[model samples]
Target: MFSVIMYHHINSDDLPLSNSDTMMDAHLAYISDHFTTLFPGDPITPGSICLTFDDAYYDFYHYVFPLLKKYNLKAILAVPSAYILEDTEIAPEQRLSLKHHEIYDGDNYKTYAPFCTYTELREMIQSTHVVIASHSMHHVNLSEDSVDLEQEIFGSKVVLEEKLGYRIESFVLPYGKYNNAAVALAREHYSYVFRIGNALNPSWEGIGGLIYRVKGDGLKTADELFNPFKQMGYWFKTMIKMLKGSR
Candidate 1:
């Protein structure tokens, strides 16, 4: 089955929501070992591998881009258009501090740290290997904020298309939280929707599972990427853990 690997940060230090470089290398190595790397338009087969990252973080530009070039792989990056427009560059120290601390919270949503700037995003796009997508206006939780839901979902598409100068067809629901209304809203714009969790195949419950993914952290070694057994073990365990948590 086709498997999309979801990743976040690729920074040197381990941020709270980060995957260490060691883990990232091992994950990619495993792909090279067990499956052939496939592009967006490539024919799909069982065990096909596609890479994706949510929230255009600075580490992706700083760390992940080089690896992508080295391996000659293609991947997608989903970004918060408004945040990128602000052009905020997060330093390692600032990132660590936010991860360790709670920056803000309202209703049940929380904000942690700053993300990458539009400049960095433009730089990433310069690499022919990377494609940009939308994550929403402010990374807002669409499942609960029904009043602003229209703006959050549709507005993001407009912003991203304008900023990146391309039509964005993919999206990752922030926190993997959504309801019927949100889904209905998303269907109007996005062709593929990604949820956060570990599974070989994404949920086919609706338009949600068109793209399935397993999280890959950079903390593991590059060798792990090439080891099918190790990657499978991690994938299975992660899926089980997420299933149990959902229940």
Candidate 2:
């Protein structure tokens, strides 16, 4: 079974959405010891692990990037196109004040915690260890019918490709909320789509377009995540969710 771990902020601050750099390093070490790290397009195998970061936070560039290089592993970075296009810088104090989810919600996020810059992204991509994928154009919840599907869904792909000069084949659904319409729209654009949830993705079937990922915030330590009993709990939760037809 393969697992896709989801992460948000990787900062030293005590924020609700952040995991300390030390803790992140521990998680990476544990995964390196226990599983083969894989990227978006790589064939999923038993004990395969994929690390994905959401929101394209600057801290990912500040903390996660170097650690990933040190561990000699690859990760998928889900970026909102507007955040990169805006290219604003985040203040130290503001990083402590705002929740990670709030970073994509309002104008304050634009004024406060900045997303990764294009220059930084270029440098990171050159490393050949990072796979850039679309989070959305403005991080809007796509489940709403009033949403501009064409813009948020398709437009973001266009913007990222144009700016990054690469074919973005993967996308992550925002807030882990999606309707049938949203999924259909995403499937039309991306080869793979990721959702926030816990499940063991089996490799018997080729890696499907819709993928489920576990919440990384709940994992405070490597032991908390790697424990076999805890893993069974994750599987049980995923099974219940699937039975409810949620994922």
Candidate 3:
């Protein structure tokens, strides 16, 4: 079955949503050996897999990009446009608030890591193995009534295209929460909109709506994914969920 795997941070340190570089290497190696890695716009084939990274962490520049180059794989990066833009330009107070919270490593807590800069993003995109997509303007939950749906959904797309000088055809739902309104808004702006979940989509159909993604952040090794029984069990549960029509 085809799978779209989602990753957040790639680092050696043990932190929230962090996966080690070693484990990432293993995952890539296993995927390369077993599946056809596909890009966002590519026609999905049997046993195809797509890799995606959320949050546009700086660690992805340092850790993930090089490995992608080594493995000759392509991935989509979902970037929160506001974070890439000057923090002062948006909600300065909220930026300060988020910065105050630190991430805990295995031994000690440290200041939260920074997101990738524009230069870094350009470098990655130039590599031709990375596709940049919108995560949102501020990474807010689109389900909330208080949210400005136009700004969060369409605004991010405009910003990324303007700043990066290219059209962004894909989007990932922030927090994986969305309502009918949110879905409609996303459809107006992007060719693909992804959600956090575990299931495989028909590659030939393309991702025009809510595409499910399997979480890769918690995995410690490739073996966990390569096991046939585990793979079947995972798909079996997904099948049950699908039959129930549950998200």
Candidate 4:
């Protein structure tokens, strides 16, 4: 069985969407020693783990990325199409104060940028340890009936590919919220669709194009991440979700 762990910022501030550098070191050390880490295009071999970071925060490039390299682990960094700046002179520290939601304001760019810049992303993509995934344009909630599927779904793919100079193979729902229409459109463009369902993706069989993910951001230690009881909860919920036909 395989599991996909969702993460956000890797900063010293310890915000809700972040993990400190120390905690991140612990996570990578333990995960590297224990399980085989996989990425989107890799085979879903048994016992493989997919370590994915969302929003492509600047701290990820500054902090978590080095840990990933030191540990020799692979990770998928999800980037929202619009938030990524073309280039920036702002200090990464100044940018760190900005959070995901606040990035929507165009006025915010005058000061600092929160998300990864195209320059930074290009550097990471050249490395063997990272792969890019689209997090949609503007990070909007795609389940909304008023949302434009072209811009939020396929349009994001086009933008990222143009900016990063490669095809993006995966789509991660901005808030892990989606409906049939959203999922259907994502399937048309991506090989994988990552969403929060807290279930173990034991295999790709009958999985459609969807790859379910569980929250691992709150975990302080790898022991807590794979606690037997918690793993049982995953198994139990996996059964329930499969039985109920839930995604």
lDDT of each: 0.65, 0.78, 0.75, 0.82
Write model 1 residue lDDT over 91-162, tens digit each, in one string. 545544443123223311113235566666777778777888788887878778554877788899998778
TM-score of 1: 0.74
Which predicted model would earn the best TM-score? 4
Please report the candidate that would top lDDT against the real structure: 4
Candidate 3, which ten residues in sequence have the lowest lDDT sum? 103-112
Give Cα distance to truth, residue 232, candidate 1, Å.
7.4
Task: Estimate, for each residue in 128-173, the C-alpha lDDT of model 4 and write its tens digit.
Answer: 8899999999788898888998899899999999988888989999
Model 2 residue 239 CA deviation in Å: 4.9
lDDT tens digits by residue: candidate 3, 59-166: 787788998899898899999887663321323222222321332222111133366667778888999989998999988899999999999999999988888888
Error of model 3, residue 239, in angstroms: 2.9
**TM-score of model 4 relative to the true fold?**
0.93
For residues 1-247, write the lDDT of model 2, one tens digit per residue: 6788888887634355568888888988887777888877687777788888998887888788998899888899999888774354555456446555566566755667557877778888999879898998988889998899889889999998888888898889998888888888988989888987677665422234468887786456765776889789878876675566555
Q: Over the full model, what C-alpha lDDT does candidate 4 score relative to the true structure?
A: 0.82
lDDT of model 4, residue 54: 89
Off by over 4 Å in 4: 12-14, 99-101, 205-208
TM-score for each predicted model, relative to the true structure: 0.74, 0.86, 0.83, 0.93
Report the alpha-carbon TM-score of model 2 versus the true structure.
0.86
Q: In angstroms, give how far residue 211 of model 1 lies from its true place.
A: 2.5
Question: What's the count of clashing pairs in each model shown?
Answer: 22, 0, 0, 0
